[model samples]
Each structure stands twice: as C-alpha cells, then as structure tokens.
Target chain A: MRFYESKTAPASKGDLTPMIDMTFQLIAFFMLLVNFTDAEQDQRVRLPESILAVPPDEPYEERLTIQLASKDVIIFAGSEFSSLDQLSRALLVEKQILEAREKKVSDTTIIIRADRESKTGKVQEIIQACQTLEFLKFALRGKQAEVRVRSPSN
Target chain B: MRIRHAGREDTTELQMTPMIDIVFQLLVFFVMTFRIALPEGDFSIQMPSASASATLEPQTSPTLQVRLKARADGELTSITLDGTSMSDFTDLQQRIRRIVRDSAGPGESGSDREVEIDCDYHLKYDYVIQAITAISGYVDPETRTPHKLIERIRFAPLQK
Candidate 1:
C-alpha cells in the first residue's frame, strides 16, 4: 500500500500577530470615536432634516438638552417627564446643579430635539414652558445636510 | 519537548482561534449598535421674557410674524407674512430682504430686526425648517458672510 506516495513539504505556521494587531486597532478606533450619544437624544426618534442646520456657536455658553419624544413625553438629563411642567421642574433641578458650578442656567442655550413626527406646537409648548421658567434662549435641532439644498437666496 | 528535524517545516504556529473569536465578537457589537446619523445643528431662536423685556428694544425693531397654517395631515397649506399671503418661498425671501434693507445698515444688517414664527398646532417640523430657511437669509458665497434677514427669531403663540 502506498499510504504516503505523493507527499508535499510540511507547511510552516502562519503568523496571526499582524491580524490581531490590526483587529485591536480597529476596535480601539470604534471605542474612541464612536458616537457615545447623549441620554437626551433617543436614537429611535427620527430627526427632521435641514440643510440650514449648523452647530451652535460658543459664548452662547452653557447648553442644556431637552428631548420631546411626543406631545406628552419629554426627557431631559436622564429622567422622562410626562408633562411640560414636570420637564421644567427637572430643568430647574439641572439649573441648580449648573448654578452650583457657577454657571448661569439663564445663559443656557436650550436645544429642543423633538422627533420628526411630533407636532410643531408640542415643541412650541415645551418652549413656552421653558420660557415660563425663564430659560428663554432656545435652539431647534434637525438632521443636517440631507441635501446639498440650494437655498432661494443662497 | 521533541526536537524538530532541521529544515523540516517548523510546526510552531500562532493559534488564531481565540483572537479571531474576540475580534469578531467586537465587530458584531459595534456593527449592530452604530448610529449613522448625528445631530449637527442647533438653529438658535430667542423669546423675550417679561423680566428682560427692556433690553430687546422691541419698539426700535418691529417684529415680523410669519404664519404657517397646516392641514390635518401636518403639511403646510398657507404661509403668510404679517397677514400678506406669500406666493412662495422666493416671494417670502424678497419681502424679508426688503424688510431688512429698510431697517438694517451696511454693517448693521438685521441687528435690530426680530422675526416671530407663528406655527399652527398640527404642522410638521419639516415645514417649520423650510420656513426658517426661507426667512433666515442665505450665506453669501461672495464675501463668505452669513446674511441675516433677521438675527433674532422667536416662535409666536401657537394657534389652534
């Protein structure tokens, strides 16, 4: 019997060090640069799109995030508040926290990240609630650059 | 330990089983949880509070109200600028520019102007953004300047 009639040379071991090193680098990249999204923004909510949207300028100084999930459902910091009144109370607590750090809550640039499906007036009511609480400065958030939208005046 | 024959294929090898397993697991986790879209903009608007009413100089600068009336399906049916119905966004822009030109100086464009957006109860946010883009003048590619038809924009009381 010719069990090992036509035999090739024994194979050398392949080095996995390079593969492991490259994999680790990729993992590190995702870990460091991946979006660690804020608690105020729920990824499930589809945001509205706008070509005019741009990041807020500093010296508007302290900022607060208020998410309007629906007309009744709102969230700020970490707690979900059902009513605008409740949301403002939570905002008040946050203002105190900021004031403890010598920051002015009044100077805060409030970002309203309402869902695309939510009514505009729901967002407006949240603004009214914030306004009633004296947190008057506001900003509306939208998904930026969906189109290279040509503005009428641009 | 058994000695290998010289020039025979050195059997010693890097065991990649564990490393591949861990790497694949990490890849799966990030791939599933990765968020593609990011919130990149905070278009600023301000409301004049009763306490800080004096600093806004409302008397010096008239507030232009942009009214957006929407249908039950949350689409805008009409856009009116201070009771005058605008034909389209272009007309809206022209009227706003004229408003700014009348009050604003060469260097003081829209400094003294204020804009109030009166949105209906059921309007979708898309139309609001469209309205904002229309009234909030475009960026001047010429001088790389952001031309402001009005710097101060506030939402008016929501009408049912």
Candidate 2:
C-alpha cells in the first residue's frame, strides 16, 4: 500500500490594523471631549434659554448650586427639599460649613438652576433663602441659545 | 563544497490577545462613560439682604420695574415695563434700548441702568428669563454684537 500525504492551507486572518486605527481615533476624539468636572447640571431642571447667556470669563472659586425642579422641589448638594423652610435649614447648615472652613459665605456664589416650568416664585424663594443666609451673589443659570441673526429691516 | 547554513530564519509570534483585550476594554469604558454636556451660562445678580439694602442710601437713577403677569396655568399673560403694558419681550427690549440711549451720559456706558423684575407667583420661570434677556441686553441687528441695556437686575420682594 502507498501512503498519501495530506496538504492543509493555513486559516486566513482578517486585517485588524484598520479596525484598531479607527478605534484609536474614536478613543482620542472621546478623550478630547470628555468633561471630568462636575457640571452641576441636573436632568430634572430644564434651564431657560437666553441668547445673552454667556459663560463667565472665569469660574467662581466657591459656588453652591441649587436646582429648582418642577413642583417646588429644590435639589441641593444631592438632597431634595420640597419646601422653603427645609431648604433654608439646609442653607443655614451650608453657611455654617463655609464659616468653619474660613470661607466667606458672601463670596460663595449661589447658582440657581430653575426649570422652565417651575414657578418664578420658587426661584425668588430660593434666592430669598440664600439672601437670609448671607449669600448675596446669585447666578441664574440658563442654557445658551442658538444664535439667529435678525434682519435690520425687521 | 560542504553546504553550511550560517544562520536560520526565526519566525517570532507576537502575543496580541492581551493587547487587543485591553484596548477593547478601554473603548467600552469610554463609550459607557461618555456624556454630552450642554453649554450653560449664568446671569449674575448681586442682591443684598433686605436689611442690608435698607442701610444703603437711595440711588439717583430711577429703578426700572418690570411686572410679569401669568394665568392660572403658569403661562405669561402680560408684561408691563414701569406700569406700561408691553406687547411682548421684543417691545420691552426696544423701549429699554431707547431709554438707555436717551439717558446715557457722555462718559456713561449704561452699565448703571438697573431693572427690577416683579413676577407673579404662578408665572412660569421661562417668561422671567425672557424678560431678563430683554431687559439685560440685546444683540445689535447689523453687527451681531451684544449691547448692554441694563447690567443690574434684581427681583422684587417675593409676594405670597
């Protein structure tokens, strides 16, 4: 009997260089756009739009973000308060903390993020509460509106 | 002549499994953590407490008061600038621009112009912002540059 030799070709491998290159490009894009800072933007509050609402030249050194959700709910420091009294109490405590840290409560800006549908009075109440706590500086947050050029005739 | 192979060809295989796995992991992590942050800005208002304001002497420039009225459903019903009814925020802006231009002194930049917003309790917050936007500044129609009408804005005392 004669012995026959068997021949087998090596399995083909798809090119991974292009895929790897594309993936690396994607990674770089995301890395460049990734924001690591706490934006203090809560999903519950939809900020009103303003064309003049430009970002500050420099970020405030110390700031407190108070979000006013719809239906009079105030979110501060990750906690939700449904009433002005509760929020005031929390702000009083915040004032004490700032004082303990040797930080001027007046120097710390109070940023108000109020939902579009939320009552204007609630925003005023939050500001009043902050004022009571000696937070004189208040920043009303609004999303930057898309620029639409108006005709001089109009 | 005797055949002598001085050097033999060596095929070295690189281990790609570990590197590919790590790269995939990093991609997945970034994809999961990716979030698009919206561009936000602030309208800063420096308001002292009522008591503090009381201590300071009254100002020479008259305060421009804007009153916003809303219906039961929290929609803007009407807007009034210094007791004068405004058709809309556009009208308010025009009137403000005229006032600022007329009252501006030679050296004055109109930054001293102040507007007080008095809004109804049930009014939607959107209208307040619109009023503020109208009262605070306006973009030049031809140049597209923003011009300040009033830099100082404060809300009126909270009403029940």
Candidate 3:
C-alpha cells in the first residue's frame, strides 16, 4: 500500500536539461556547416561541360586570383587591387624586389576566376595588366560539370 | 526555547542567462555567415552539340590559344592564351601564321595549319561566330578562296 501511494504521487518538476542540450547541439551543427557566399556570385553564367574536369591533385599555392564581377574587377590576393595600372605597377615592384633578393624572379602564376556575366573586356584588362607586369604564367579556373540523371519513369 | 531553534535549508540555482546569450549570438553569427552553394558558370556552359568523335591524341607542339572577350558595347578584347598575352590580335595572327608556315612540312602549306580559340563563356554567340569568320581570312590558303580549313574548334570552359 505504501509503494502504490508513492508511485501515484505527481511529478515534482519538468526536466529541461535535455531540451537545452539538444538545442545547443543543433546550433553547433549549423555553425560548422555554414559557408559564406560573397558578392561575386556567378549565378547567370553557364559553364561548358567536360569529362576531364577533375579537382587539383593537391591544393594549389596561394596565387593571385582576379574576379571579374559585373561592375568592377575584384583582385583578391590577400589584399584587393582595384586599378589595373596600379595592380600592374605593384606586380612589377614585387617582381623587381624578388629578383633583387633571390637574384631570380619567381614565376608567380596568376589565376583568373571571372563570372560568366562579366564583360570579356574586364577579363582582358586583368590579363593585360599581368602581362605588363611580366607575370606570364596564368591559369583560367573552371568548375566541373554535373551529371544529369533522368527519372526512372521517363 | 526549544521551538525557536531551527536549522537552515541549502539552496542552489544555475545561472543560464550568460550561456543562453552566447548560444543565441552564435546562432546569429552562423545565420549571417551561411552561404548557399551555387553552381559555377563554367559548369553550366551550353556547348554546341556535334557528332564528331572525341580525339584524345595530344598535339605535337604547343599552339597559341586565344580567348576573345566581347564587350556589351560591341568591343572585342583579347585575353591571354594559356596565360601569355599577345601584343595585339593582328600581331598575334601574323605571328601564328608565320610560325605555322615556317614549321610546316615541305609539302604542307599555311592552309593545313590550325589554331584553337577559347571564347569567353559570356560572349555573345554572334560575336564568337564573327570572330571565327574574321580569323578565317587570316588563315586562308589562297587569295581567291576565303575558306579556312581550321583543324578543329573546341569549346573550353572559363576557369572560375
């Protein structure tokens, strides 16, 4: 009779510790997975498909990456170089400094990563700037094509 | 006197305000920084469909690869070919022709030579077609016939 009376008594409190822990876990998962998209988003550009489109063997060295956005050419190389002429001069100065220090200029490769909608002239400007600076080695970056699959019903 | 004497009860409380504030701040930070994945422009390029067989054979020597950037105002800008910029289109064409003519076999002429063009993905279809037409004149074998026997035309995606 005493055991039955104790079991029938109402619970004292609601345990919210589990709920709080679960919420924190969910927040942490989202925090780890978030990837920030930038202003130079290539939304309208459509790329050519290629079977040979493979990822780099390993991560490439940090090189100059120029992005041709709609209105402006964004030069992303640790610091942003807005003017083409200025960028060219800067590159030239860097080359000269490197040559003086090492007795030979390093083949610092330039990577052009342009948006599809960006004007070709802008991309050319970047190339011309690099050439003026004597930074000859260049790599045009591209994304691999996705394989499309048809529904089983079709 | 005995009833007045009493023992004190122990009390404990967990301060969750600071922890909740930190969690909320983290949530906001993630929400602001979260970027939606997008397909790059090069991957979505619509290559002209053709029935030609895929050629896996490598070319004997490196050839100048030209990429033309067409402006919205109908201006054409030439970019680097494999990263090396040419002086100008006219200069580039003349140099290519001379190189091809000089490097050809005894029987082969300028007509048998070929050059590859990787047009910007954003360039208008008409501009590319026009550029190809213009380039054909520079490579024509004979003065009378303007037909350029271009060895191949390959659509290369713009690198991101």
Question: Per-residue CA lDDT of candidate 1, range B28-128, in tens?
Answer: 78766665557567677877676787674445756888988889878879989999999887688789888766443344455467788998899987778
Instruction: Please report the TM-score between candidate 3 and the true structure.
Output: 0.50
TM-score, chain B, predicted structure 1 = 0.72
lDDT of model 3 at position B42:
20
Clashes of each: 0, 0, 13
Tens digits of lDDT, candidate 3, A5-109: 455667777676886797788788887776543344344433232222334455444345555555554645434556777667667766777667663332555
Across A1-154, the per-residue lDDT of candidate 2 in tens digits comes to: 9887886878998888898898888888888787768556788889899998889999998999999988788999889988889889888999999999999998999989999999998888889888878899999999999778776678
Docking class of 3: incorrect
**Residue A61's C-alpha lDDT in candidate 2?**
87
Q: Where does candidate 3 stray beyond 4 Å?
A: A1-14, A35-54, A77-83, A90-107, A149-154, B1-9, B37-115, B118-160
Residue B16, candidate 3: Cα error in Å is 1.5
Query: What is the C-alpha lDDT profile of model 2 across B1-160, one tens digit per residue?
Result: 9887869777898877788888888888888878888888899886889888889778778999999998978999899988999999999988998888734333335468678899999999999889989988866555667777787899998886
- Greater lDDT among 1 and 3 belongs to 1
Per-residue CA lDDT of model 3 for B12-116, tens digit only, reads 787777887888788777777666654332211112222222343455766556677655554566655556776564565455555555433333333443455
What fraction of the true interface does each of the listed models get right, in terms of native contacts kept?
A: 0.68, 0.80, 0.16
Query: Comparing candidate 1 with candidate 2, which one achieves the higher DockQ?
Result: 2
Q: What TM-score number comes out for model 2? A: 0.89
